[model samples]
Target: PIPGWTLERLHKGYGQALQETEVFYDSQTDHQRLRVFDNPRFGRVMTLDGVVQVTEADNFIYHEMLTHVPILAHGAARRVLIVGGGDGGMAREALRHASAEEVTMVEIDAGVVEFCKTYLPGISQGAFDDPRLNLVIDDGAAFMRNTQKKYDVIVIDSTDPVGPGEVLFTDSFYGHAKRALTEGGILVTQNGVPFVQGEELTNSMRAFKALFADWGCYLATVPTYAGGPMAFGWGTDGPGRAVTLAELEARAAAAGLSTEYYTPEVHKAAFALPGYVRRLM
Candidate 1:
């Protein structure tokens, strides 16, 4: 607390005390029109895809794991639906499976999609240019209700239950998602970190369980997100739906996806819950 020392210098020195970070790049997406920022340590950083999404440092691991695991578990998946993945990164992974014939992406915000396509090319890469991807700028719930066709897998890659995505976590939405899937189809949604928000996780799981025959709440580590640990809920209408790492790895090998974070060894490990977490269910 010196007279001449500015607050900016104090903050900068405090940050340097723990770690000095810099924003290498940032821009506004032309699609859904959200801001995208990237730093050196946290790769492919913040993306406000309609609701200040992905502020954490390590977004890739969480994004990749959430979209891929269920698709792999379904095994014979061909057509897929990704709700709220405006960055198109999920579409990139969805099409990685040779069995995946088509991927329909439904994003509520067109501005976010456009901005990512133009600015955050590192995450989406050349995904938008791919012929297999059909990008729709619309409400995912409405899209699910209107489509007559069914999909092998449905992934809910949305932000927290607030603003544009509040409806996504509702019971009715889960019921709608159930109808959008084929018989024995698998559904996965991004829940928040259970450790930080235990009640939210429990409530969301209870809602999904009411609509499905079986459910699994698993954990993943993403340094960029809040709490550094995140959770995902896999809801299915059949018992014994959990896929072991051995199974997922064999499938990944056949498909030939050189993934950075997801591996068969990590798959089983991810689902292994701690004692307190087991108590919550």
Candidate 2:
């Protein structure tokens, strides 16, 4: 362990610490305590209320899987909705697809967006300035509950199911998200690491199972997110999950995506959950 490492005590009796080489911003936002710092291995790191949110390195795994899987599977998702993700990473990836004509992101904390844009510009990569992105600084749950607008894909790039993010994991929120989707649309959420936060995945899966015809989760390994592989909840009323490998290959080719982590094969294999993670769902 490093002598002056910042400890993140997200779970009881377990924690992850990183040595901060340079602290850029550490202050309380209107919603939570937000911090941005640089680590030797992880590059720039951002945390919300003491929990790791995104790192300069390895955010590609989480952001790519969360956004591309649904968009590629849907094949023609013109309008996408992102709940939370004030850092703009989700919007960044979602807008990569030319098929996504409009990407609407609702974030509760404007401070998070501003701080990340300044401190972690590489993560969002100029997605905030894109004409296709409509950024809304508001409570994500409230927006979902009232929005009459429909999306072909909805990505819940939220924090863990705690504090302000707690409302986003409720049955009511999932119900609203389902209603906000177009026919055959897909919804994905951040369900945490199943090894430690098993209950979180199970609870979200339960809500999804009740609301959608198909519900499950996919795995992605984010080194900053400790314990084990993190799970992203998947739910939709259509055949998105059953997209053939050849079709996915064709779509990937068509999109002309230059990615570091995402591929059609990996996307398919991510859903092949291990027994321990499967048990959680």
Candidate 3:
């Protein structure tokens, strides 16, 4: 209960408090209570409804893994679809691949995008202005249900499976996302930390197992998304998951990407689930 610190009580028993060096934006949006503040260690931080969403320091780990893994694994992801990445960090990473000709990002809240652009531009880094990006402001599940256009890779960069983001974790939504993919396309989702949010990952994986020929979860240790490694749900009818390490290395070299946390080795190693997480899948 420090005077100036913002305590994020996402879990019932666990919480993280960041000392707010400067409060940037703290108010209500149409969907949730959006707060953007400056912290000494994490730099700019954005929180939605008292839960930390993204931070300047370690966003690269989340964004890079979510975008690069599927795109690079697919090896020719020309069209990408992003659901609920309003902050534009996902788009920034997806657009990094010259192979991705078009990246369509569907976000529910235009307010989140607007405020993120104004307050946390460094996280997005001019991705919203990219010519290849087709920004659509809409509900992610609805868009997936109706969109006739197929994608090589679809990333569900949504918040925790609660409130507005709850629908994104449902079996019906996973079915729609599976249908929205082109032949041999991949679908990845932001399943929460398995240690704390085990049910979330299990539910998503259950749906994925029913919908796709291949279904599993991967690990990424994001400092902000506490409780061990955060799991990204992986579901695909494609052979992307079977891609070898040598091939990934070649792709990384060809793309010539300069990343902070992602590499070909990391990409391959991410899928090796620990025993506890494996039981959830």
TM-score for each prediction?
Answer: 0.84, 0.98, 0.99
On residues 1-281, what C-alpha lDDT tens digit does candidate 1 reach at each position?
43321111211132111121443334454433344444355444444532335533445687778767777778888888999988777887887887888888999888777666665776677888888888898888788778888888999998776557778888888888989988888888888667665665787788887888888677887654445367888888843256766778788898897887888777667788887666665
Tell me which residue pairs clash in candidate 3. Answer: none
Q: Candidate 2 lDDT, tens digit per residue, 1-281? A: 56658999999899998999999999999999999999999999999999999998889999999999999999999999999999989999998999899999999999999999999999899999999999999999999999999999999999998898999999999999999999999999999999999999999999999999999999999999999899999999999999999999999999998788999999999999899998888
Model 1 bad stretches (over 4 Å): 1-33, 49-52, 55-57
lDDT winner, 1 or 2: 2
- Per-residue alpha-carbon lDDT of model 3 for 147-194, expressed as tens digits? 999999999999998889999999999999999999999999999999
lDDT of each prediction vs. the true structure? 0.71, 0.94, 0.94
- After aligning candidate 3 to the native by TM-score, how far in Å is the CA of 130 from where it should be? 0.7
Error of 2 at 119 (Å): 0.9
